[model samples]
Target: MTGTRDRLAAQLEQWANRAHAARIAAPRRRPMPAGFLRGVSYAMTNRVDSSYASPRSFETLRALAKRDVNSISIMPFAFSRTASDPEIGFIHRNPSGETDEGTVLAVVHARQVGMSAMLKPQIWLGGGAFVGEIAMDREEDWKEWFADYRRFIVHNAVVAEAGQAELFCVGTELSKTEIRDGQWRSVIAAVRLATGAPLLYASNWAAGAVRVPFWDALDAIGVDFYDPLSANPLASDAELVLGARRAYAPLARLASTHRKPVVFTEAGYPPVRGAWLTPHEEPMDRPLDPEHAGRAIAAVFAALEREPGWKGVYWWKVFSDGQPAAPGSRDHNILGRAAERVVASAYARIARAVAGAPAR
Candidate 1:
């Protein structure tokens, strides 16, 4: 897991480095199309072959639509042994359970239900290493990692093109690699060559978003927001809402600076005690506390729903089979939790507002 200091350091470095101009080569920036996405992440199961194509997967999509969700982020994962292994790709014939064929099926199902899909290809690191720790000590190692990464991401873009995804996310939450402007430019270029779909590289919240130098090369700003709403685990409702407002205040400036919509590609608080204190991590010992989780997520919606330059948000995960990955160790799913009601209500309100008002 990424410690507070490590995450802060990455963010601060990006801020300081901004004074020095980054020389990146790419086509002129194009504006993203008009729309807001109310999305939920649908993850593929590693053990279940053709999981995304299952009837349960389609059922999950319908369930989300009932909650007023208008979009879904389809997740198919790649793997690496450790942070610096320089070997990044599929572990076998079907890496992370769902294949390109499965992803296409998921997208087709989502479209059948009148919801747009964002094909998001992400990396799942082994050895308990964080994606932010994916750095190499040698230049050759970095080169090797990027070489394989380019192929991996380009393959995903091809998948997105086939799926006809509403949006295509090149990568997710890989903070350490955000500084490789030249390498990333090449990767983005490859994806562009492969597909005409819109692209985004989802950044980790706050500092991670700041670290990504290639946001200008992409369509919209994608952020996986797990920023702490309060250091206090037992923060009051007002305190929680205040924390969320303060956390998102800077993003308004981020939107203006980039001249693009800021989308929360991932957002959620684990249904566990003190999740508000470190919204990103899933601690092993915290007891389940649906009340705390519901309040924390409601605060985020309360803060961002009316904020300017905010395009949309995708809740940070709901599995296809519709359950937590595990009870304690991986209980981030909102289904069967109090947070589900909060999300349903919030998304419903968003829908009403969008339907009744002028284009944002």
Candidate 2:
């Protein structure tokens, strides 16, 4: 036990030093104020050069704006070889939309279309592994991973600052690393130096949001909330709404304890039958059912829309090309689906009341 503690301590110490240096290298800038964040996650494709900010992309933002969506979380992803492999960086032949220039372009265009942008750089591991499962078995590997992640985050922080993004997400769903509380704080500090954009960390819906020791350091509590609202596919809307409240009851308590706003960094149901039974997965052989998706979202809104600490939800995703999703898609797109109508209804209320910001 003593040996384990010593190795962990040493690992943290080495990582913290490198993180501090990264922070020092970022340019200074004043952060813009935060906003209501009623929006959807943007970018479903690995777009090539300049495509994310083309005139068609601007039209996409215009479409969302017309639907009462006031913001979008731009998901720019970097890849790691495997969950356990610690080398986190952009690939040489990365998609342009994931590059620094692409992120800045998306941010600029979102602003032009009267929408706020949250620059969220996510890590995609090989084999389609869940990011929350990322872990390092060796002390040296952990140390190297943390050092590399600091660089990844700081570099993107510079991009977020350059684009004047309204919000910046440091890390998302890397729960296995959340145990290193002190080192995570150092990483956040490094991001602060690199960008003045208000910081938020996206936590896994199950545990990270409740247990992360450094929530006090961020501007808001962010959770990629895919918690199942009901196990029964035939459950009525009332039952689902009850389930939603029960699931969020503890989360609401967490917000009360932190006295910070709670935002759904990501949340959406696939337009599939029984999706509410498994909000995070698209089970095989399930028929596409847009009505169920709409019901699930409406239930969530009924449960949390007026909750004091509730700020907003960024719906799981929409296509980046300004093109409509395929009508028969099983993916979590709300565009032109029944869920899209539910979103417009909920977001309209947010635009008229919560944000109080007039449309462009």
- Give stretches of model 2 more than 4 Å off: 1-35, 92-95, 355-360
Please, what is the whole-model Cα lDDT of each candidate in the order they appear?
0.81, 0.82
**For residues 26-67, could you state the per-residue lDDT of candidate 2 as single tens digits?**
455444344467889997465562356566677788899999
- Model 1 ranges with Cα > 4 A deviation: 1-34, 47-50, 91-96, 324-330, 356-359
TM-score of predicted structure 1: 0.87
Against the true structure, whose lDDT is highest?
2
Residue 264 of model 2, lDDT score: 86
